[model samples]
Target: MWADKSYTEVTFKGCRPTEPASNFDKSVDIQLYTAGFGDKVGPLKHFTKCFELSTSTATWTGLPKGLYYFKIVKIGGESHELKKIDVDQVRVDTTLAD
Candidate 1:
């Protein structure tokens, strides 16, 4: 979703991938970066912090605003990411769960 405001209520609903290799796990390290090419939304250029959620209960406590593009970094020394996307949302459920 595209926005033109510095403040926005981004709801990280979660993700449900059919393939198990594309699911967001608990050890995933998401890296959020503002789209530096799209008019520059805010002064914030890097990720402020990271968040952790349960795969069973779909809920987000606190997600940062002013973020444009974000990537999920695979943890647990995995070769590939379980799931990755270019948005300000987080995954609440995995393929195996749902």
Candidate 2:
């Protein structure tokens, strides 16, 4: 999860497979969805972005201020959702002075 005044960049860390033999070659897929509008309200949902992680750390940037749903997909032997994240109201600080 991440929040910033100017922009939002969510950083995710990669974890080692529990069974190295079975999950060694697996890859991470990130999917972002807009939950709703105004403090995470409403039911109008939409897909926002998708990313494939190829490094130890992955970052998702340029996100608008709203509620977001994330799904981490592990693709290898069998594709499955590894985790889910819900980000509510990503705030921006427009009052910061340079």
By summed lDDT, which 10 consecutive residues of candidate 1 come out lowest? 52-61
Which residue segments of model 2 deviate by more than 4 Å? Answer: 1-6, 37-55, 81-98
> Each model's TM-score, in the order given?
0.31, 0.42
Best by lDDT: 2
lDDT of 2: 0.38
Q: Per-residue CA lDDT of candidate 2, range 29-70, in tens?
A: 445455543232222212232222222323334555655555
Q: What tens-digit string does per-residue lDDT give for candidate 1 at 1-98?
A: 33223332223433333345345342333333456654422222222223233221222223344335534434422433444433235442212222
Which pairs clash in model 1? Answer: 14-92, 22-82
- lDDT for 74 in candidate 1 is 44
lDDT of each: 0.34, 0.38
Clashing pairs in 2: 5-93
